[model samples]
Target: MAEMIKEPIENYGLSSKDRKKTLFSKIGIVGCGKEGSKIATVAATAGIEVVFLEISDDRIQQAFDRIGSELDMRIATWGLTESEKKTILGRIKGTLTFAAFKNCDFVIEAVRYDDNGERSLNHRKEIFHELENILAEDAIIATNASSVVITELASELKYKERCVCLHFVMMQPQSRILEIVRGLYTSDSCYNKVCQFAKLIGYDFVTVEESAGLISNRLFFILLNEACAILQEGLTTPIEIDSIIKVGLGQRQGVFCMADQMGIEKIVPQMEDLYKEFGSLKYKPSPLLLRLNRAKRWGVSTRIGFYEYDEEGNRIINENEKK
Candidate 1:
């Protein structure tokens, strides 16, 4: 018998020529906490591969659990299918080392905020150094931090032109707006590429000056503070106030409800930062928020904030409201 003729693997299998080539194809996230995991899931759902780094295996697993739970909620609402969820989850990978980010052309640092809702600038600077050592010179570096000025972080890096800030207001998934801030040293090419990235992940982008709270948080925190003041004055309840905002102002949700979604712990600190930056009393965190933060009723993550939520994160309806 004649020997079998050699064949090209691409011909026998999927053709290499058919493979899609795109920038932002693979990205990395330095932290897999709440915001980090949300972006990871969103990117994976958009068909981009994601690699998220955590400090330990347990933390990585926790991030995975959180992402899965979010997808389950979408599935329950008919927004996602089981197979699509599987595919999205399959595209995300967790790691304990920055080395995993070496191949990522774009990496976002979405680390958890401390009790005060702030990440130490020194700590973030160190993270930038580690990423710079691993990634290519032209790779884009970004932070999902609304308060920290991108200019401050960029000043710490050798490739200062590659640094930018993307404040993702993840109050609701459908709230697909991204506040993209370019640092003083950020190059125009880097800014344009990041805009493309926002588009890739199915987000609309807004150019913002390097301010502590960008646009959304500045407006949101002030509105939330006023609502708290009204409650303190005994003028209205949270539910009633929410109704006014939703029905009257046409906001998708009330400020109190949106705050619960934002988590009290995260809210207080960011507000504190704004107050500290601008020295404005309006940006000061409300007493109610401080109490909630102290009590650790951190929104849906803890299943409670202004309202209570069930295991699936759905708010439990009060019996009185049932009438």
Candidate 2:
């Protein structure tokens, strides 16, 4: 069945008071990949117009499809109605041109990692320049990276004070918490606006110092690396390790399972970045991760990583595994 479209509230029927002030009225997202799609959905769900840039027409359609599928999942779970999905979808627009970003109150640069899991700093800085040229001087520009790219990207901008970084938590649309990074050049007004934007989207923000891997990725890399080492040393199976983390540590998912969800492809490059920044062996990507990434096994995205998965992304158990 074709999805119905509804007129978004932001597009019409606003009172004179609402017309007087605009608070993040429009958000532009560069690179509508896995992470970008989620951010777009969140902002659009909050009734903000979301203009997302994709590389091509097909990629733009794919991003819309991904967002629709996620909404369908919520509909299936009774979290959203069909009408609400239509409203949210109506608020999102996909484009190939940065010209669509003009006049955007808030813009997020969320470039995806390449197939090899590497993202170039120079390329990201170029995107920063691109956004700065289009957005207003007071508009905020943020990157959706956990690494230390924010400060350097900000430094290249004419309005360096308006640049900040935000790291959305993995694995959910409604994650309540967001990690906010303030660059050295980021102004107090910019940081405060980002925090206000977070609250507008129903997320609480945490301030993190400028560092490679920021807060979540730094701690998560260590936990995932230790888990990988345990698997390498033959101390436990992937399933068992996950079980211990779930049952013993009371985590929602085991470290390995979450790693798979986040993609080994993305994780490995971040580990390399962190290692280069801090020169710590603990931040190094485990041998197992590199092997899997080299083999092109990108976890749930590819249906293979630490564990095999079927087409539906459900893990397939081995015959020898104990129930």
lDDT to native, each model = 0.89, 0.88
Q: Which pairs of residues collide in model 2?
A: none
Error of 2 at 202 (Å): 0.8
Model 2, position 155: C-alpha lDDT score: 78
Instruction: Extract clashing residue pairs from model 1.
Output: none
In candidate 1, what are the lDDT values of residues 1-323, reduced to their tens digit?
99999977776657767664479989999999879998998899999999999999999999999999999989999999999999999999999999999889999999887766568889998999999999989899999988888898889688899999998887765688899999999999999999998898889989999888889989899899999899999997888999999899988888877888888888888888889899999999989889999999988878998889998777888986688
lDDT score, candidate 2, position 71: 92
Q: How accurate is candidate 2 locally (lDDT)?
A: 0.88
Scored by lDDT, model 1 comes in at 0.89
| Candidate 2 residue lDDT tens string, 1-323 | 99999875766757464565587999999998989999999899999999999989999999999899999999999999999999999999999899999979899988888887777789888988988888888989999988756878877677899999999987433466899998889999999999999999998889988888878888888999899899999997998999998899988888877888889998998899889899999999999999999998889889998888998777888887744
Best by lDDT: 1
